[model samples]
Target: MTSNPPIPMRPIRTAQSRFPWHHFSMRFSSTPRGARLARRLAGERLDAWGVPYGSDTHDTVTLIVAELSANAVSHGLVPGRDFRLRLSAEGTTLRVEVTDTRGEKVPALVEPSDNLDGGGEGGRGLLLVAALADRWGWYPCADGPGKTVWAVCSASVLAAPSP
Candidate 1:
């Protein structure tokens, strides 16, 4: 009797492999109310994605969204245009991106000392984003006259156990 060659075993797939990634995108008016709505919705979405509402991951992402959205509304606003918020989770990272029509008004990370010395009440948005996000930056939108500010939170923060 001839013995047939044994078949190779396939690697087992994890839960992440089954779902791959999650994404959310929405356009909001370039207004403070709109920014507030974006932040609330972002937290809700994160909670749905297994990052509990009060978890570090959820709070960090939502705060990033709030800052970026506020910047878009405050600095990147163009009359009759709206800002866009996009969130995506893949692998062990969660990325938050906010896009606005005014590409020329790029955000800068002002030194905290400079703002404090000047008695300024603002200009600290990017500073907070840099502190909370593992990485953050901006790029011109490919399909439109705008810029997208993005921040990423890695598993180091995202892996925190739910309380």
Candidate 2:
């Protein structure tokens, strides 16, 4: 009989294990007011998470939430349905998710062109989201209708996790 050596097991290190995990979610009407609320609520939650109200992290996350929510209202709105906003924090990363009942209207990234109109602000919402978020993407909602657009912002530009 041959005996096999025991395999060493490594500990799984996750943000949940290193720091307190925070999450917030709310459903809002698919209207302009809802987009505004999403942005405001995200900022409030980040403040509660100890990021401070006017810190860079807070500002970036707020902008991401605003842009994503606005996109949902303008492009993904489905009559009689509401949109959802979710925020989660783990370790040095904060994530934002906006879900609307229009799975067919998935967001696409547009290349930056010299002729783009922004006047130094940004060409569009997704463009601002792309510039601000360390990472961003979209996926079909698990429960029922629509898709979820998500963004992640890191504590610092250098601290962004590799793709």
Candidate 3:
């Protein structure tokens, strides 16, 4: 009888492990007020999700959300069309996705050429998003109405365990 050593057992990493998609979708008017509501409601939503207000993850996600939603209102607003926002947690990853009705005008990483968008301002929105997100990106909305701006956050409240 021949006996073989047991095979080494290592965990396999899957995309699902990195981003579990729990969805919260709502439509808001394409206005400055909508943008403000997006940021405010993000805090409320996070609290309901067990992330609590003022927690590191909550704050990070909220800021990213504000920037994205602001961009939606400013650059992607379409008459009579509202914008949508969704937030979900996949394991230790927090995902923020904002959709707006301007598919032709896609977002990109822009370099700030000057410090003069205004006093004490300029090129800071996306800058903050880039700094806070572990991996951030966007894609055309599959529904064909607009584009989706997304960012992933490493949850400060509950980190994903090592595989």
Candidate 4:
């Protein structure tokens, strides 16, 4: 009779455990064009972080960026000032942040139905953000006279091994 040696046990690593933190930040003009650019750049950055274009994680993050950027341009715009976009990924979490120099105009999440019933063309951005993001909020910027709106979405795909 032959006896096989016991196989050595190894700790299993999850997708969240294997992924390292990644960050991207940039400032854009407080204009419609700048907002568009921010969304495009965010998509590219997600691709670089292994989130892949067209994936759910990629799309969600991009949409959040688009909405936040648009709000910054339309509501938070300060002449001669630019807005800032920051993206950070750690494990299964992806965070999107948009900062503009308008501390007075804080965002609020209102019922979407209310706006739609009134035949309003806008005012649903925050509602969409609330639906899509696992968690979101805003705070006054620590270093400047402005505010930063942020949202976080869970990206299970971020844990998948890169092909």
Candidate 5:
């Protein structure tokens, strides 16, 4: 009996595999203006990636960028340090990440019953992020002294019929 060589098992590619294009990143000052610019540029980048303005994905991502960027400015700001905004699209998922130099002020998820509105000054941004994003979390910056907050929103999924 002849022994046959084992067949190679190739990795399967799903709908998420055939990526056409998806990546964006930029640095901004740790200020309110920088936060606003982050949101604007993120929208433009999504438009360039075929997500278009006024689309659900575009709006959701833009909001996420705004909230995270604002958090970086308000809670994570360190004088003279700049924050970074990174956008990535994989499959039907769009990820928004904002990094700042203040890792000590890590974000916390507030309960619906929490006094987000009663506090007055602020504290509702992450709540908005939680409501809109499919998933979100944060981690310490890999190469520096800070943290990167990230959120993911589902995109292009509802725009088309699934097989």
Candidate 6:
């Protein structure tokens, strides 16, 4: 059998094969459980895309997306509104994007404050996201409220085994 066989997918806004988008998305209640579900579902979807459960690609992507989703629930929460998680694997790039309805809470990569202790109640989530992601950033919604915190983990991450 050929290694790294092509993954099939439908066109999204005229998305092409080279731009092949293997995607899954869900809207979840703005709660802790919803954040957890986002993470689990991401792992499952990646598995369906040939990223093995314990593979580095799976674990890294799952963890980063989970942390970001959790932040969405904790900080960007809006009453009655849910958060969304979208995963897309194209060629050698995997993109994870999480959007919440709260427009005011602009996600940022905070600098570790002097008061920031190795042991603290908050502040580690995005730090971990930064460390794990090959490239990460956030952008304001072009046509509406809220922002999307997205991260891209390089395909080479899969070249290694999960620790």
- Against the reference, the lDDT scores of all candidates come to 0.84, 0.78, 0.77, 0.84, 0.79, 0.79
Candidate 6 C-alpha lDDT tens digits along 11-129: 32221222355777889889999999989888878876767788677789999988999999999988998989999988667899999877788777776566655745677789998
Alpha-carbon deviation at 34 in model 1, angstroms: 0.2
Clashing pairs in 2: none
Question: Which sections of candidate 1 miss by over 4 Å?
Answer: 1-20, 113-119
Error of 6 at 141 (Å): 1.2
- Which runs in model 5 stand beyond 4 Å of their true positions? 1-19, 111-119, 155-158, 161-163
Poorest stretch of ten by lDDT in candidate 3: 6-15
lDDT for each residue of candidate 2 in 86-133, tens digit (9 for 90 to 100):
998776677899999999877997754666565543438888888898
> Number of clashing residue pairs in every model?
0, 0, 1, 0, 0, 0
| Backbone clashes in model 4, listed as residue pairs | none
Best by lDDT: 1
TM-score of each candidate?
0.83, 0.77, 0.76, 0.82, 0.79, 0.79
Judged by whole-model lDDT over C-alpha atoms, candidate 5 comes out at 0.79
Best by TM-score: 1
In candidate 6, stretches whose alpha carbon ends up further than 4 angstroms from where it belongs are 1-20, 111-119, 160-163
Order the candidates by lDDT, highest first — what do you get?
A: 1, 4, 6, 5, 2, 3
Model 4 misses residue 25 by how many Å?
A: 0.6
* Model 6 steric clash pairs: none
Rank order (by TM-score, best first): 1, 4, 6, 5, 2, 3
Per-residue C-alpha lDDT of model 4 across residues 88-119, encoded as one tens digit per residue: 87767889999999999989977555455556
Model 6 accuracy (lDDT, Cα): 0.79
Worst 10 residues of 4 by lDDT: 4-13
State the TM-score for model 4.
Answer: 0.82
Residue 27 of model 2 has an lDDT of 98
- Given candidate 3, what's the lDDT at residue 100? 94
Error of 2 at 77 (Å): 0.3
Q: Residue 24 error for model 3, in Å?
A: 1.3
